[model samples]
Target: MLNAAETRCDALIVLADVDHVIHVPLPNFTFQRSIDLQGILKSFLRKALVERTGQIERWDRGTWESFLSPLWKCVVEPVMDALAFSTPGDLSRIFWCPTGPFVFLPIHAAGLYDTKYSAPGHKVFDFVVSSYVPTLSILAPSRNIYVAHNDDFRLLAVRQPPTDGRRLSRLPGVHTELKHIKEVITNSGSACATFLEPSVGTVEEVLGLMNEADWVHFACHGIQDAKNPIDSGLCLANERRLKISDIIGLSRSRGGLAFLSACQTATGDEGLSDEAIHIAAGMLFAGYAGVIGTMWSISDTLAPIVARDMYEHLFRNGTRPDYREAAWALHEAIGRVRESGEVSFNEWVPFIHVGL
Candidate 1:
């Protein structure tokens, strides 16, 4: 294995499946059986650690084969044999491997991989936490790591029907909401201009403005071709599909943030990293400063509310909020809705922040 000193990158990014951690738990078994289960868990952890950390010097054959081997034999293997059969995609995808002290993984793995794993959402965080901490701590003790997690990562069906159901105008003050978010963005005084697409807008129109604007906001439906996920894209005026490739080709802009108010615009299908082209991610990989996206289907009322709060956090109050902060602001805004008793908690809490 390569040592951290020999590695070239400054930080590591982990793609975690939050659903897995929230839904799966270690099997309930006799003390001896649980101990045996631990061993198998360790094996998978070791492999993921090696691949993700890219550290070659941490490898210790005898340490792994002898001391650690039995640890899993006694604790993790049994849990795997009993529960693996019933685990859902969300639970199965939970990864607890720790890369560095500075590594930033999705929430599920981040909290789980830490020593002080007893935090909010601790139960779901346990599977990952119990799985990775011991091994990685021994391998890399001097790196910095961070985790991003939220309850909204889970799949939730939209509860309310779209008001207009067909036309953008029927969306209950869609223009006003767009204007508010755009103004909040402009108030940041970042020289970024915002545009609201009514329907299927063209790539040429986007490219023309994106070339000069420091920020771009797309408050429209972004469809992911479930069959061919990368072919998925945002819908513009006229029912045109703006494929993932089209979004990736934009030129660079300084401190640019593309707020994709589109659904599941930040996901990738399993088995291929190249196919994991999220509109927000593609923009980031193509050199945008950051991107904010949703994880699954969202409530129409909630999305605009979240966007309004995010833009307010970013452009209003002179706060220079980053992508994460902006996303949180949106969450906070929705929390207020639940607090005020205007709508239930299920109404306006459907957004997540995705970025580098």
Candidate 2:
């Protein structure tokens, strides 16, 4: 559990059915709504997902536009006001531990969509860098380990081939991504091993190498099984699927990091969203100290760019390569992409860092 004394935030936003409680060192006043806030949140999430998945025909852009006002009024605005009024200084980082349907909402991307108030300094991302955890207890063990600056680390990169009968689009960028990562790590005099298509990229092969790796990067397709969370897995070569159960069963000690550059790797089952039973959390449960993942689908072209920038920032800090600051590195990478104006929401917002 988080120590109230050691908490770095101004306040913690805890959502409930009819109202949300803002915890600013103590349980503060609740924001009440006449409507069923939970139902509204779920509806908003469903609409967002539909638009994200290109199924927006069911609801027009106007309808989607209409939903945002209630979302901001009922869910976001109250929390923002509470933090601004109660907090001592400027807000920098926010750790949103959402529950139930609220978990599916993109709290980091919350903003007024109108162009009048949609400037760079007017949004949530401008206020703070957001980090999420299923529960605060998972943070306890990671605090014990010292993140030493060691360049003698080993990396395992896996890139799956386009499987037949699978809906996954082929990621040609995986080749560029792996190549860039290899060049970066090896140029730093670190060990880098890869399992590329057709032969080496399999569930069995990747699992075999995971224990010895200081970091593991999976550049493939991720499937989220809403019915059975454990069965949700990464699609690899020859139609092989590496499930969450396979990852949790590893006997390795608690250490290292995982970069799941796949779709929905951080998205848990809607039915069990509070449990954080997704592939990203599964990696943590499998003993990884840090994880970088996507909340929804990401662009194939932009994935390599983001990955390249992130690794460059992470592994090439002056002379000493440090992977300990994964979250900061990712935040910078996303900022760079956003500033470039090449890609927007689906490409940038989906990428998130969990764990340490």
Candidate 3:
């Protein structure tokens, strides 16, 4: 299967009661397994990992920190050890295509939780920057040509107010996020337009602007419908949901980047986890070359901070704001948050870049 593949492949096949390493004759080759990985994954998922509402619930720092330590020892350490021994060099970027419950775990942030086992260059992040794709075959096609940074490049910023049914709390951070992003783009001489709440942040209105905008940033709440993934969507103004099925129908010929700053935008149904048929992947299929999404719920207060840092890195003087650089920029932005010590797993780890 690896030989016949035309695209870059990284297969992570999970099996029961097996602890071994295997190597395939391919460009990037190495695979390792743990004897209790399947059991451990099942146990981890049952604990506050996923919610009854089809969302992945946030665990308190104490709970998650304790959980991460064992998870790192059992699952991540062995895999990293094998990769380090087999591939000797500076590990730069890796696209993790995880399967089953591994999809829900934060493999990028795997490391020793306590200071006792801590050492330099121990965490996964220290080795290589990580991105994710549902499958290798889906990434075969050339990415959508991005509009160069110039006067003609456009950005659409959508901010939805609290709705009656959902009654989401006011996201003050979202206001700050939009302001900073707009200032950055306008200062760079790129065109930017906003759809504010209680007026124009509707499914139909945003869809109309999607084709013209070079980039789209949505600050709102997301819903994951486990029973019907297509019905899952971002909650817009007036209680309207912009379903995944709706996004897939868009005629977005001029592909661009989409920043889904909402809850559960990247969470997939447990039954269909391997398919990667979630909101993030849906955006890719809808024509965007790159997508920024959250695997679970994130702190509203820290959302803008991450966004500000990300745009700062992305719009730095000499850097080009292209989809290819999205993952690197996001990784650095999360690093900034981690350095600050204000927020950790709940905020920093949830922000991930999918697609190119």
Top-scoring candidate (lDDT): 3
Candidate ranking under lDDT, highest first, comes to 3, 2, 1
Candidate 3 Cα deviation (angstroms), residue 166: 5.6
Candidate 1 all-Cα RMSD = 15.9
What are the per-residue Cα lDDT tens digits for candidate 1 across 1-356? 00011223111222233223222222332334322433343343335321111121232333333333332332233333334423322233222332222111122211121236334332222232221121222223222222222211111011111334343222343455576765665566543443533542466876666665555676666676656756777766565667777766766543455777665565454334222445655665555554666544445555667667766765555534444344345445654664575553223322444442
TM-score, one value per model: 0.51, 0.77, 0.79
lDDT tens per residue, model 2, 110-212: 5565556655544556566667777776556444374554655677788857545346556667888788887777676545555555565667777888887
Superior candidate under TM-score, 1 versus 3? 3
lDDT of each: 0.42, 0.66, 0.68
Candidate order by decreasing TM-score? 3, 2, 1
Clash pairs (backbone) in predicted model 2 = none
Residue-level lDDT for 211 in candidate 3: 72
